[model samples]
Target: MLRQGVSTRPARAGQACRGRPVPFSGSRLRSSTACGAAEVAEAPAAAPAAPQGLGDLPNVVSVLRARGLVQEITAAEELEAAAGAGRLSVYCGFDPTADSLHLGNLLGIVVLAWFQRCGHEPVALLGGATGRVGDPSGRSTERPVLSEEQIEGNVSAIGALLRSVLLRNSPPGAPPVRVLNNLDWFGPMSFLAFLREVGKFARVGTMMAKDSVRTRMESEQGISFTEFTYQLLQGYDFVHLCREHGVRVQIGGSDQWGNITAGTDLIRRLLGGEGKEPPACYGLTFPLLVDSEGRKFGKSVGGAIWLSAERLSPYKFYQYLFQVTDADVIKLLKMLTFLPLSEVDALQAAMGQPGYVPNTAQRRLAEEVTRFVHGEEGLAQAIKATEALKPGAATQLDAATLETVAGDAPSAALPRAAVEGALLADVMATVKLQPSKSAARKLIKGGGVYLNNAKVGEELYKLAPADLIDGRMLLLAAGKKNKMLIRIQD
Candidate 1:
């Protein structure tokens, strides 16, 4: 069996909240309360709760609860109004800086898919233009600038993956998924025109006040002006969407709260400034997926566990889910899988019961998620690989399958003569199992090393040809992060 490793990345940061100006910005658009009491006093009081039809919208709280991620809704009344309006236009963005979305991005994509299913028009925004100016929300350092050609390639690849995933999960006759590149608008956008129109209202101090910006300033790596203006650029995107597509809601990760709100505020200000009836817009942020250990979801030492098959193989993806802890499994099932409530609850309870390991639940979770993204064929491969590795399962697997799995893993080759009558330390050393002789001895004494899928003991089990399941191969595992395929050639 392949030993799996635990992975972690940084936790996603702050989300936008209502009535509070973003945590970092200065008084940009003077609020009535802070700007002028007379003007504020004369303005209309906060509107009363409007009637809501959100229950009629697709997936609602049930999906949110299933994912175990908090849906930080703007307001009940706001959601109701949008639902009643028939086809609430909403947009979510994916930066094309990366060729593929990772598991962390899956939640956002699923949310958009569900929104479309619920009768809201969904817009997939490819941050072609904004991506040129990196978003600083989650970054500790500035991203290296990409060439124009690289950016275009990333956008194309990302779009293909986005279309594939959304089409797989989306129901028939759901709002048609529209793909947009911000570059279309921004490419032709002139600096003078932008300054005269969009930039006038977005004050520098107000922009700097965001937690994303504040965090950047305090960080040793420092922030760039391009990254700082990312929110404003995002705000302008909302205005563009509002005017062009009637999109009124922007949904994103909680770290995107500042940007989402900027878009909403832009809509309000732009329309009001021009003496037009202000178009209504709403913002919603979903909580970032974090494990029980409090680390951000996605990433192992091998690097990001990507959705793209090219980046992360289906077998590896299945193994990632299989390694989930009991505490995180149910939460993941809810967030990542479409398993029904009754079934999920039963599985959760079973996992908690004495002597019940979470393997079955994890496998089911992995299967559902893998199938949803990669389809039946993908799941079949995962199952096949799993069966090939499980104890007592080797005989059922063919030589080709064994070779395929072994070939995919990091490998070592040894002469048949060298393995015979060798100390376990020497065996470990020959295969580069440990970096040094001392470490190899420690591993042998601690019984942390395995030979041919079984734990090695006595530190001196001499290798024999009979121990090779296929008369050629040996599987060695070091802790959970390392797997070495060894072949004894004649």
Candidate 2:
């Protein structure tokens, strides 16, 4: 029940789009895109369609359940009816708590894509307003309020990410995903107006009963009135989207049940009670994606696996997915990828067969997800990176690819003069590769030191100009898996 956001140093400005290159004279390595305002890769011309296996199925719930996407539903029959009813307008909201949406938000956006393929309309809501107060649903402590400018910046970057991932590969005439910011509506209303209109309909007793509030109230840090009233804001968002955009359904992660149900209840009380014919508002939630130990599975040992290649490089992103345990690959494939069920079953079957490789399943999951988020070009770049770091790739690697690899790996800087004609032992000592010159000498003599993926057997060898990839940096390794980038400062 930790709060969703973490403060990270802003990725420096030298990293810009691959198409629009930014000249770098900085210490940290950078990708082709600007880290702060990362660009989305353009999608291919074609789009994937609904499976032929789903022909005339009554609803997509069966699909979701088989895929492990559905955790809770407010109205099972009504949800089925909406899916079967043709061209439903539905949405899932994402708060701009971070500059980019992380792995946790993957299920929500993928659900939206599934609806679009089913020929329904999907809307993506950026919480320009709700993000300000912060979501308390999954937290044990109070969320620190964010500034207007900070939230707004997060809103724009996340909007671009959703659009790139969701709007690609439409079947013949599918509607493009409609993106909205909650602040567009919430910004205009005064505090007194919100209290008189939205807040007036809420019940203090029911609000107090919500698990998020109940848990927080009993904690050392009691709930704030601002957070307690957050339900009203979310409910109003549903009402506004429904009334203004013709959106009829809301979907989200399971932690959102209280807030989601609050919206449906508001719709029923405010709209259906007024003699509205259909009473069409609905809410559905999927279980939060978790691992075998039941911990949420998106954050890596490093941090949240961000969708942006600029934030989390495609190579690291692919490696993260490629490393999922055999126990979790099937469930993750069902949740994160759009592979047909038949293909998923084959991969699952392979996991149980004799001499079958788990890497096959892990590799498939990595390829599908990498292509989806980073595009085919990004996937190719990731594959090239995977090759560059392999056992025998040293001599064949090019400068730009080496730069991309350095951009993804841990890196440090040194004056060029320090590296020129410097002994391997001193270089290792300077980069913290070893505790001291003695330790560096011992490691080099013991066959533990590798320069640019090639083992170094010499303790007193001087680095030649050719040892620097692109004549700019030295790739250092203390062992098979321990590596670092040394960027030579001009």
In candidate 2, the residue pairs with backbone N, CA or C atoms under 3 Å apart (3 or more residues apart, or in different chains) clash, namely 15-34, 16-32, 16-33, 16-34, 17-33, 47-169
For candidate 2, lDDT tens digit of each residue in 294-402?
9898897779989987688888888899998988898899899989889999989878899996489999999999998888988988888887676545555566666
Model 1: per-residue Cα lDDT over 1-490, one tens digit each? 0001001100110111112222223311111122111110011124321123334454443455455554666664666555555556578999877888898988888777667656665778888788788889987899888877788878888877877777666665455566667766665556666777888888778777888899999988788878988898899999877765567778889999888878888888886665566766778888887889988878887788799877777777888888888788888888777676789999988876898864889888899888877778777877787765664343244444556476356788888787655666776777787886577778867877766556676665667766675777777667644767777778
* Model 1 CA deviation exceeding 4 Å by range: 1-62, 273-275, 354-357, 394-404, 407-410, 413-490
Using all chains and alpha carbons, the TM-scores for the candidates as numbered come to 0.72, 0.80
Q: Model 2 Cα RMSD, Å? A: 11.1
User: What's the CA error at residue 483 for candidate 1, in Å?
Assistant: 9.3
Which regions of candidate 2 fall more than 4 Å away from where they truly are?
Answer: 1-58, 169-172, 403-414, 418-467, 476-484
Q: Which candidate tops TM-score?
A: 2
Locate the minimum summed-lDDT window of 10 residues in model 1.
1-10
What's model 2's overall lDDT? 0.77
Native-to-model Cα distance after best TM-score fit, residue 397 in candidate 2, in Å: 2.6
